[model samples]
Every structure is written in C-alpha cells, then in structure tokens.
Target: MPAKLTILTNGSIKVEGDFEVCDPQGGVFNVAGKPAVFLCRCGQSAKKPFCDGAHKTCGFTSEVKASA
Candidate 1:
C-alpha cells in the first residue's frame, strides 16, 4: 500500500502503509515491517521523530484542513 498520513486531533500524525522515514541527512528510521507509526507534531516528544503521547499533557492544539 502507498504511504498515508493522518493528523490526529491534539496529537501526533499517524503514519501507515509502505513507508520509511528519513532525516535531512538521508538517515533512515527503522520502521520496516511495522504496521504504523505515530510521528510527533507537538515538538514535545522526547522521542523526537516518534510520538510518545506527550501532546496529551503538553496542551498541544492544532486543526489542519486541506485546501480545495
């Protein structure tokens, strides 16, 4: 399946399907064979690129909408 990203309300961005996360330097994240991943959007995650559920306690809020 193609990569899909779902931004959660007041939380992390849900990532699914065939995908691999890479940093700006071309380093790849070890997400192989995983069903999904929650990426940090709040910028409060100690896990950096991954979500550790910090948004729940950090008072993060965002409502993103797609442009038509």
Candidate 2:
C-alpha cells in the first residue's frame, strides 16, 4: 500500500503503509515489519524521532490542516 501520513492535532504524525524514516547521514530507522508508526512533532518525545506520548504532558499545542 502507498504510504499515508496523518498529522495529529497537538500530537505526533501518524504514518501508515510502506515507508521509511532516515536521518541526514542516511541511517534508517527500524520500522521494518511494522504496520504503522507515530513520528514526533512536539519535540518532547524521549524517543527522539518517534513519539513517546510526551506531547500529552509537555504543553504542546498545534492544529494544522492541509491546503491545496
């Protein structure tokens, strides 16, 4: 399936389908064999690029909508 990215309000970016997460040096994140993953947006996640539900207590606030 094609990858789909959903930006959650005041939270992480929910990712589904086939995709890959990599760093600048081309080191890839281990999302292998997983159906879905949540990427951090609040920067409060102890898991770095991945969300650890830290936004719930970090006082983060954001609500974005796509525009075309």
lDDT leader: 2
Clashes of 1: 0
| Weakest lDDT window of 10 consecutive positions for candidate 2 | 39-48
Residue lDDT tens for model 2, 12-40: 99999989999999999999998999999
Per-residue lDDT tens digits for candidate 1, residues 20-46, read 999999999998889999999999999
Best by TM-score: 2
Question: Which whole-number lDDT from 0 to 100 does residue 12 have in model 2?
Answer: 97
Q: What value does the lDDT take at residue 17 in candidate 1? A: 93
